[model samples]
Target chain A: MDLTADMTNQPFPTQLFGDDAIDTAEEKAKPSSRQTVGDPFVENPRMICRDVYVYYAEKCAINNVSIDVGRNEVLAMIGPSGCGKSTFLRCLNRMNDTVGTCRVEGDIRLDDMNIYDPSVDVVPLRASVGMVFQKPNPFPKSIFDNVAYGPKIHGLVSNKTELAEIVETSLTKAGLWNEVKDRLHEPGTGLSGGQQQRLCIARAIAVSPEVILMDEPCSALDPIATAKVEELIAELREQFSIVIVTHAMQQAARVSQRTAYFHLGDLIEVGPTDRIFTNPRHQLTEDYITGRFG
Target chain B: MQNTPQQSPITLRINAGLKKRYNTEKRFKRMGISAIVIAMTFLVFLFGSIISNGYTAFQQTYIQLDVSFDQTFFTGENLAAANFPGLVKKTLYSMFPDVTSRNDKKLLTQLVSSNAAFRLMGMVTKDPKLIGTTQKIWVLADDDVDMLIKGHYDRNVAESNRRINDKQLAWIDALAANGKITKKFNTQFFTSGDSREPEQAGIWGATRGSIYTLFIALALSFPIGVAAAIYLEEFAPNNGWTDLIEININNLAAVPSIIFGLLGLAIFINFWGMPRSTPLVGGLVLTLVTLPTIIIAGRAALKSVPPSIREAALGIGASKIQMVTHHVLPLAMPGMLTGTIIGMARALGETAPLLMIGMIAFIVDIPGSVTDPATVLPVQIFLWADSPERAFTEKTSAAIIMLLAFLMLMNGLAVYFRNKFERKW
Candidate 1:
């Protein structure tokens, strides 16, 4: 492949070039064969990305990625470790600001506003776009405090009674209120593993976020806890747009409405979850789904 | 089986060397247990010796005398005009009545401390009515007399080598036989304040000062240290400023505590001109020395909070400050408190730093304010230990016991806090 041409030519139509196009171009310069696949679930996109590139010092971690996440949909990004799926997820909430060497270029917008705009307040931005982590981590406080924390910070409750009510409703929505209602004063960390993850979900819901970003929220959980979280994610999509990064292909197929495949820091293909699993258009996507290579 | 046995006799055993190595391993295990036992025995022996030698220092003896106030000597004319020391000597000689006799004079002088005169004068000035009335009094005897009563005096030793002579022993024996001088448990040693007289001083002043200083230290250190730690650990951007601050805090932790005392002396004492020898300055010095400890521990505690908890808070739209205050700080409090108590304990035992700021003196009154001159337990012990009087040896040991008790209490508090609030997850 002629790497020099891609690096030097600013106007080169990268879409027209296949993996072997550069090698063939030196001989004939013929237009490379190309096919376009539409993402069916992008009818009402909430976040649209175009040519997103994330760099860490000298190395590029996310290179030339473009995708869209739809409203009230569960969008799952699946890739192997260091494939940049989690990096892309963090970019959604601007959580990557915490990383010292990381830098991002290109356009990422929520609705019509650029999220990376300097005028944006990160506090409200994070509130609008919430995130869950791989492990179940509850505050080392009462179970009620865990759920009430978000509402209190956002000033959603005017009094203790209102806070208590918010805590109850949030826990009920997360489907954990019944089991822990009698023990609201007990430390949240005292709960079982699955219960703790659900408590975390309750905590997230208490803030009334519009979007929730989850970075492998079930990776550390047992099969049963993973199933519970998956079910909750499906239920959660009725109210909020959810972006999830997962290594489990089966989980993506089970819970997501749309699936985006990431490989070698590039967005290979994105489409309806069923279509991506059944008949992927991209050769890389097909190979990955068929277990030929990741 | 017989054929197999015969074949085994001819065959080489490949694992025979391994069996020999296993036997050596068994021998090593036996030696390991013996080493552990020997180490434990030595530790026990050391502990036993410390308790045995230090136990007697907790008790003291006093002489109860029905001292008659000589109306002629302490009249209004004498009180307004008499030399304080001369009046004290005249009153003391009246109690013995043999101070002028050459042989008995030495005995009489050795029975009471020279500083006793000053202490008596102070008492007379406080209540002039006692000048004309005979009142029962409990006075602390001289160090040699105290040593005799406590069995520290070696009567068989040469007169020149001993602090007390045979004549002094005779007077002590007479007083003991007459029931005028008796050994009683020294409750005042724990309740009263420090004095120049070794027999009269107590840990009360220094102990109270330590409490007040630690109170201030914990009050300031816990909140400021935890807040700074939380900001740096959870919210601060990974920039040069934060990095430099982290390094400075670590260096502060390693800096000699005495340097902090010098800083306090310069800034709080000379510059600010706060009261010298006050618990306020001592507390301020201790706070500087303790801040690094609290901050380091607080940072560790904040770091111990799993990143997942922060993410959970962030996910809910909590602000950076909110996330730290609501989640991170609460989880880290147990460890933070443990650090605070440990820092206070270290402050309690610190003598050199407090000494630099003028905490090494007699403060005979309980401090009513932080600005009042005070001496802490360690400094009190140091002062007592440096006294020339032989009785101060026991007083120093008593002061050490008080200091150690305070330290143990602080350590116990640390352990209790850790266990009470430690998160299982």
Candidate 2:
């Protein structure tokens, strides 16, 4: 009932305060700014975003935001629906270029090179930065064909024997080779939900991409499948950088080396997974982690 | 407490308004069922009429005539020097047994086909060594005799109205009783070619033409349509080149089939100067008409493939073109093939377009090549349907049956392909 009254006659903090009160407030903000400088987690950034914004037509979906993904790290992005975590993940590979009206502004770099550079070809970019969707989207073909698809396209193998070897190695890395090798000719869709996800991973790995992005890859899978995928992600970090967007906070804490908390298109806090969960600096991040609000 | 135990709590479980809504929902479902039943009934009626009227066309009737080779007229020395019409006239006289007057001979000659003599001459010339040998030969009788054998003619009809007199009937009866002339199954209907005489005509030539034309259509349309579809759906960027092609393909599919006929006539016949009425021209015209259908269906099949599959391939570093050729095309093939076959079936039934392109009346010996003149089944049926001969009515019906059978077979093939290779994913 008091909501309308607060909206129309809202008073500014500095307007209501004297000079001494403003001085005290400025001193408090200074200590926090100094505290941010000494944070060890921000030191070695893998992917650094500075003032990134994305817009569709007139609507700003992702407002100015900045964060860093550390080297050899699993950084999980979590937010409520429409919070732009997925949008930010797509920026890593310039996948948003596929959309007609989507406009991305500001700098996003992979190591040192700007990924959004007009000179960059999306084909190779997508190859280096692979993405896994929420659903287990396996090709409607044999498991062998599915795994061989990427390697064959890039001419990674010289002949049939070499392609077969690549498929075997990729499937083995995804922990799916032994289960599916005997029935490689069977259609990929015949596999269970978890197996299909792992097959997708094998397909992704076959091309030997540098980074893997999972966008709620286990959302369509059962709990068992989700757990298997989570294990795969943790193991995957040793070979490639992994960025994941998830709705499950517990999953993020369990799998990620670092966590970035986002709310309303803003990157509120990012730190080691344990610190983000146990000792968040931002009130919004704390509220989300503690289940007080999303 | 005892009094309270006696009266259980009065529960209201069902709402009156909700109950009414449930009843209305039931009524709506019943109405939907009835509507579906009505639609099915209409479809059944159409199918029933087509099958019933068309089924009889598959079987045909023919009057088998056993003519004795006259040694005098077909003498070995004279056969080479004799005109075929003279031998045909002598054979027609043989059919009468005894013609007392010249007027009766003339009337009897009219009853026989003008080309009947040519056919007899052909038989004699095939075996000049047999010119001296007298043997029984089976020849197709004239249309009137064939109608009489098939029970379409009445002997009791008035002489003025009847095409054949009672005397001719007596002669036919005498010949039938003596086993010289009899009605038998017309196997020639499947083996012989077109003739001016309705009784002698068969589906063989047109059937062969259709087969050859369809072969050409399948060879050209399937590969081209599918390739274009794959390029448009997978590799080509969504720019003006692809947009223009897509628009043209869609427009081409809807263009009047007659326009394709005109195109075939002008381009293939006039400019390229291909043989008129050739299966090549017909096939080329049909391919143009069929390409759009196949491409549209192929695109739909390609689009049905989920984007996640493409991402999986891309994630693996598969090039865009490789992803399409290896993964997308195989999945889309069944639907594409089905579309091609359905388009071909539609092409098989097209008469008006073929007519405009000169496939209507060409009397070809055989469809030797794309450059050779040819006639297809529907065109043959159309020719038969337009003839003034009363017997050709049955021949047209018979040809219709053959055309329908071909269409059914194509449709069946489409169903088979769809079932056998359609991927669930």
Q: Using lDDT as the measure, which candidate wins?
A: 1
List model 2 lDDT by residue over A97-129, tens digit each: 656688999887666667888887777777788
lDDT of 1 by residue, A56-155 (tens): 8889999887676778999999866788999999998888876779898877777656788889878788877877877887887789988888777778
* Candidate 1 segments exceeding 4 Å error: A1-36, A160-165, B1-50, B66-106, B109-138, B215-220, B239-245, B361-366
Off by over 4 Å in 2: A1-51, A159-161, B1-85, B88-96, B109-128, B216-220, B227-255, B263-275, B362-364
lDDT at B381, model 1: 76
- Give the lowest summed-lDDT range of ten residues in model 2 chain B: B7-16
Candidate 1: RMSD over Cα atoms?
6.9
- Kindly state the number of residue pairs that clash in model 1: 2
The whole-model C-alpha lDDT of candidate 1 against the native structure comes to 0.77
Using Cα atoms, each model's DockQ against the true complex is 0.51, 0.42
Choose the strongest candidate by DockQ.
1
After TM-score superposition, the amount by which residue B27's alpha carbon in candidate 1 deviates from its true location, in angstroms, is: 8.9
